[model samples]
Target chain A: MEQDLSAPGILTSQLDQAIGWARKYSIFQYPFVTACCGMEFMSVACSHYDIDRFGAGFPRFSPRQADVLMVVGTISHKIAPVLRRIYDQMAAPKWVVAFGVCTCTGGFYDNYATVQGIDTILPVDLYIPGCPPRPETVLEGLMLLQKKIQAQGRRA
Target chain B: MDLAPILSDIEALCGAPLSARGAGSDTVLTVPPAKARAAVEFLKAKHGFNVLVDLTCVDYQGFGKGTQNVSPAPEGRRFKLVYRLMALDAGTGLIKARLALDSWVDGESVPATIKDLFPAADWLEREVWDMFGVRFADRPDVKRILMYPEFTGHPLRKDYPIKKRQPLIGPADASARERLSPADLRPRIVE
Candidate 1:
């Protein structure tokens, strides 16, 4: 069994490709929604914008089942520890997407209450830059994430 | 029914104000420390000023230029408390008799609390206490309303730098090992 594990050939490579392709399609997301961008996320998740085309429409509220962490709004310093804790609780091979300008760069709240950017605490995968990114932009970001997942997947 | 009679009644309780302004039917009065609560109690009982809209504090250390109707304060008297009260009028919903009670207190002195009169003053005073670090003389609880208990300085004070942050944990804390990453929790080190 150990010799077979050590040997990397066509069969294992084909299995890796199959796994990556499967992972790229079906994504269970955990939305860490805090402020206004949550409204846009709801619009994108609901029937109007329809996020189901990307196969990531179903949201897992619990962090354990989710592979993607979509942080949806302003993350204040008061809530930063909680955000960090939630990120830590999610299983490995998890990706974090900063949803708005506030989560991306703290927007206009350059004060005591707001965290300047989320990257200071947790490592971020992609940043969707807007006060609230439009639904079309969100779909684009989702596609970008799928590409990222595909690239990162073959390693497993 | 009129503001004059109400002002006279308030003045009878708390002597004359430091500065008084009459903007329409409302009265904006800046009273002395101890007498303001008496006047508020009287207004609630006698007049129809039942609603305590807000109880807030302002740190005037580097107070900027103001509007035409500005109340002047003495030197070293930095913190000013503003209490807004409203009367529920039948004709105009809830703003028939709006009274703004403004008072100055040094950072060291504790002002007499009107929380006994208005239940809303409990949270409002606590919010002021949390933001400006001003304490009321006879308040019930000493909990911080907006900021956490571990938070040191008041964030809303004029002297407080806008960008200065006192975080509860992580990034800035010395013992930041409490915060864990995905790499930290892995069963084995990845080659």
Candidate 2:
């Protein structure tokens, strides 16, 4: 049973680090796009911005398969229940990123129709604030989410 | 471009001359509620007003209420259903007609519907019913078009509260679980 205890500790730590790194890179995104911000989201995912470089190129339509929920536009009160159900359907270790000002704080639609913020219904892990955030900002948000995932993996 | 020749013909059919007002290339004809359908039919069939551009309603609740010195309708008339008809021919342009109706307090019907004459009035009349609580008589499929079925109150009315919220919780039958307000839950109680 005395099988090199020092070597085993180093190998275990290295393996954990490798697992965390892998988890940080691979993110299956569910884009819950509703309005004009979807156009900006397209630009980010397209060839010019190419979200594939960060390993989040594959967009999962079904919430069950997705690890990240990218809420992209204005969510009206009528659609809130649907959004909530989608968030609930997502598997565990899930993350939510509010992609635009509408998802963050309802943008200019401060009316009875629009939801004030998606965070009231869904737990938001990141907020990318803009009327429709630029592709560069979206990339930065992705990087930030990666760091968060790495930190969470380290803790786990 | 003189509509007097056509106006005399409409007056003969309607039994009264329609009060006409000109705005640029368009002429607006104000017809009584009783003669509204006949007037619309005559204009469409004879005057070549082929397209029903838009049909809507206006609530005159706040028109004569305050210090605003804007033009007000006669005492009891509270709503106006407007129909915009467009003649898409090379020379012909547009005609707008308005039919005034009393308030919905005594539960009186608006009497006629042009849905038979113009198929486009189907959704338009439904929208008017949804927004202004004006019921179009003889129309079978009169239901809320823009708003959800569960939504209460005509939202476009001037008297409607702007901040009023009707947040639906769960399924329509699951209204019992809602603890927001007694009034909100009252619809679920089928007594």
Candidate 3:
């Protein structure tokens, strides 16, 4: 009704909500796969999992082009600097998902080489548990990210 | 050949080992620090033990506690450096022989670098140094191959704490340059 007379055919919605809705749908994700959890990540992207339905099928290999950083495996201290650099290179309005137990709390590798968790270096958005989380769990995590994208209204 | 005879004829191949003994089915030669390089050189020149399969260190700080990995360091040496050598028959493309060289490694003594004898020993020696704090004399360059340069101690040493972490960039060593992720954006752990 607000747009009935002045702007016919125009739908009315809050500016932030409209923006959030659009941003949440077109997710540009970067897969930072380092170890075994990468297997689950690969299956999630296959035909069976069908991640494209959520509008995140395309993977942007370049850090700058992506909005989501899917850290899918163990992050060793030797590679910590490189991970930090990749996280720094990504543009703002970005989110990180710790996609396995190792990335969440260093899994069972609570030793000298592995970083306790990636969160110590990068700002993480979601943590999907499981040794290598099942594809279903990854989908759930992705949906939660979409919700968070809508809730907080992260950078346009 | 089963390689068992080579153990007996080892003196004919490369002089007598400090203590020639069999570890399981394989032959192990314990040589003094001064003779390690020469023994490996002899094995390569005459016996076709050309490949340096692995070179590693074992710190026996508490061998009596958990003595499974290796027999207590020979000759009262706290650190024992093991060099694994392999020889492959060229035409057959099959392993011809395998010999392990054991030598005394101590903090005061520097082991001779064998990179010249086996080109592959370049990285393996560096790894041994990186993980066990053992350095080789006459090595062209010494750098940490697995751990970062800033890493302080050799992690595999029995004395080194397992939980010790030397992160180059993180909350542990956060500087302005490394504080890339905004603190305010650190997402709350959601159940």
Per-residue lDDT for B132-186 in model 3, tens only?
8889999647998998888899999898976566787775532223222334222
Which is better, 1 or 2, measured by TM-score? 1
Misplaced by over 4 Å in model 3 are A1-13, A154-156, B2-5, B12-18, B23-25, B66-71, B173-191
For the record, the alpha-carbon RMSD of candidate 3 to the native fold, in angstroms, is 5.5
- CAPRI quality band, candidate 3: acceptable
Per-residue lDDT of model 1, residues B94-190, tens digit only: 5677889888888887888887799889888888889988889876467898777778888888888765777655455322233223343211111
TM-score of each: 0.86, 0.78, 0.85
Question: Candidate 1: where are CA atoms >4 Å away?
Answer: A1-8, A154-156, B65-71, B89-95, B173-191
Instruction: Itemize residue pairs with steric clashes in candidate 3.
Output: none
The DockQ figures for the candidates are: 0.18, 0.09, 0.31
lDDT, each prediction: 0.78, 0.73, 0.79
Per-prediction share of native contacts kept = 0.27, 0.06, 0.48
TM-score (C-alpha, index-matched) for candidate 2: 0.78
Highest TM-score, which number?
1
Write model 2 residue lDDT over B12-80, tens digit each, in one string. 876875577764346666777777788788878877777887888777766855776774454566677
Shift in Å, residue B21, candidate 1 = 1.6
Better of 1 and 3 by DockQ: 3
> Model 2, which residues run further than 4 Å from truth?
A1-20, A154-156, B64-69, B90-111, B169-191
